[model samples]
Target: MTRGNRILLSCIYWAFVLYVFVPLLLMILMGFKDSKFIGFPIKSWTLDWYLGVFSDAEVVSTLTYSVVIAVLSTLISVVVGTWIAVLLEGRKFLGRAAIFGLTILPALVPGIISAIAFRIYARLLGIEPGMGAIIWAHAVHNVPFVALVVMARLSTLPKSQIEAARDLGADPIIAFLRITLPYLIPAVLGASIFCLLLSFDDFVRSFFLGGYEPTLPVLIFAKLRSGMSPEINAIATVALVLTAAIGIWAERFTRRTNKDAKP
Candidate 1:
């Protein structure tokens, strides 16, 4: 903790902050531009682009579609991932290592590769490209993250709680329901928010697996093909603000839940 080192670290942190926020600020600014195109030197500004987002039925529908997909996928991933985490957390099963590796393999795969693989798998299973396909892909991709978070939380859980429940004649399911599930709530909520953002922001999988109707990201990409506009910036900025708000709320809520859950 030398003065010189502190200054260097401070500079680095500010530089990183600038790198992230500068683009976001610019994007938000561009959304207010009065022109149809995106560029520098905004001679005029208006809220029309932002207003158009809500006024346009297509945009509203696509946004709703994206939210639905994210919610469905998050639910599936949370249930499946939490179960996997609970099963493997302190177990010594014969196939535990293999199962753990397979569970997380989807997260390791590159997005394009995962998307393409899912496309093929969905076709093979006779699953049409649409909501179900997108949800399936998103849930599979999100499972590893959920499992990792839940596993970390499970690691911090006191073994005494489960043992005490069992000693009271609670069965395995009852012990888990009364003791383990409550303890895992904060982690599950955090992971659900993370997965929701991931699924909503996802483009590649949604693109390949989507049908005639587009998700928000897919709709954005389609609009990009026509060329960038202030409208697109407005759309992205709105989505960014919503996701950031959710993340901040989830962080505070999870922190509060952790405090309340503490004995």
Candidate 2:
């Protein structure tokens, strides 16, 4: 590459990085501020805000609710998505491509649009909002993403291994268990994590579908109506740190697993 192109690429990359992380860095800084309000020129540093994050009963309850929904939906999404991927991989049937497109379309839809659509449908059908509704919404939203990721990994696997095993008199189920499931493990796990995080962080569907109890995002929105507080900053900072830590761990784990698989 030319030096001019190199410089251009470097500039673009750093710009994108700054676009994503600069605000997050600011939030982290605000979390440690001594003041109760969010602002520039932070005067002093303190951990008092973080210490108070759990003291709020509503926030804690909503956080737990979010965790429950995220976990339940992730499990459902991963199982259903993996099954769909397994069935569709390198297979053709009438309307197969249409089904594939439909599944993927949900992930591409704006969350608020999907949430509103589900809300209208649910009300029409008289399905009251609750944990089940929120979990169903989240699972439906996340399935396509999990399917796409798993399908991509599935495509890279050679077809001959399964065929060879079947040709050697092993049952289809046995061959799949011994060959296919083993190969798909990493992709399945990574997709599960993706689904978990997506469901956990989702706001729109949860906001609309949740009943009696609100999730963390919904709670955050309610609190933000009064403007950003030190407690909010603390929560944001903790979330950022945890997300970054998990991302780094997942990347390292993937790398190590891939490296160990090599001869």
Q: TM-scores across all candidates?
A: 0.96, 0.91
Stretches of candidate 2 exceeding 4 Å from the true structure: 1-5, 124-126, 260-263
After superposing all C-alphas onto the true structure, candidate 1 shows an RMSD in angstroms of 1.3
Note each model's CA RMSD in angstroms.
1.3, 2.0
Q: Local error of candidate 1 at 207, Å?
A: 0.7
Expressed as tens digits, the lDDT of each residue in 1-263 for candidate 1 is 89999999999999999999999999999999999878899999899999999999999999999999999999999999999999889889899999999989999999999999999999999999999999999999999999999999999999998999999999999999999998898899999999999999999999999999999989889999999999999999888999999989988998898888778
- Pairs with steric clashes in candidate 2: none
Clashes (backbone N, CA, C under 3 Å), per candidate, total 0, 0
* Residue 96 in candidate 2, Cα distance off native in Å: 1.2
Model 1: which residue pairs collide? Answer: none
lDDT of 1 at 76: 98
